[model samples]
Target: MRFTTPLSAITLMVASVKAAENPIIGLVDRITSISQDFDNALEDPNPVRIIETLPHLAYDGANLVATIVSDVTGWKNPLDNDDQLKTCATLKKFATTEEKLLTAILNDVVKVATLPLPIGGLIGLVASALKEAVDGIFGFSVKIAPVCSDAANKDKAALTDLIANIKTAI
Candidate 1:
């Protein structure tokens, strides 16, 4: 096939279509759903379930931060894919915002979960309730590829800090 139109015109069209289907959109959707879940979980009057849930939630949040960082900063072939480059920037901005929001939710949940409780009766109840609640609210299905380096990427420092804060809060 010979180029009937300019080569750049075809390239732009293909890239725009690919950008519309970027996988980052799926990640953003998951993050949005989970963020809303975290908000809803916090509204529960019982603190035991929230206590059990935040640790797993924080673990999953770490995976998201790692993937978001890798997607934005790990591109070795940025020039070869305009759609990836464009979506990388968009995803980084959006994921960072959600990360902060989720961190705030975890922080508040941790505070409530830590409040002093009567020693005997509710303690056993808290333990039993937590075991059941873990599977209900804190599990995630997405398997984010681990970021290659444990060393801090300067570009992803904010996410790193948020992940750490979530861990601490939980």
Candidate 2:
């Protein structure tokens, strides 16, 4: 009976940790999805609605990323911290540049989104430009392949380490 009680308590604690981790993982998934969708939308000829929608989506995703980072750090509200504020400002600037590029791409798409004929050539040009713009702004390739790969595999380990660091701090 004594051993059972302690074992049950340990199980409960493990379950609690898993539960906490799930939300952070879900947030990461959501961010990745939004980013990929925005990237894919740039390749469509009629992309204005997506272009218009992307800023808010990206902002929401960023906010979620910040929240998860803060949570993993055990920081009550890292958004209010000076360093985090600076990071947010930087992210906002990059996001603005990305939006501008996407808007330009969408301009071409807007001309053909509803059209029956394919606009593959124009879309290809705009996608290339958009990729360049995003790379310039973010200092990384805008290829979804690398980004999604990192997000799926590398990010989990990184987040796990981050949480461990936070636990040590506490």
- Clash tally, candidates in order: 0, 2
User: How many Å off is the CA of 155 in candidate 1?
Assistant: 5.0
Work out the TM-score per prediction.
0.45, 0.31
Q: What lDDT does each candidate get?
A: 0.43, 0.38
lDDT of 1 by residue, 66-109 (tens): 55555555433323356545444544554466566656655655
- Model 2 per-residue lDDT tens digits across residues 1-170: 01112443454455456435332223323333343454455454455654454454445444544544444445333232443344434344434443444444355355445555444443443343333322322222111123333333332333334323322322
TM-score for predicted model 1 compared with the true structure: 0.45
Candidate 2 displacement at residue 3 in angstroms? 50
Question: Model 2 — which ten-residue stretch has the worst lDDT?
Answer: 136-145
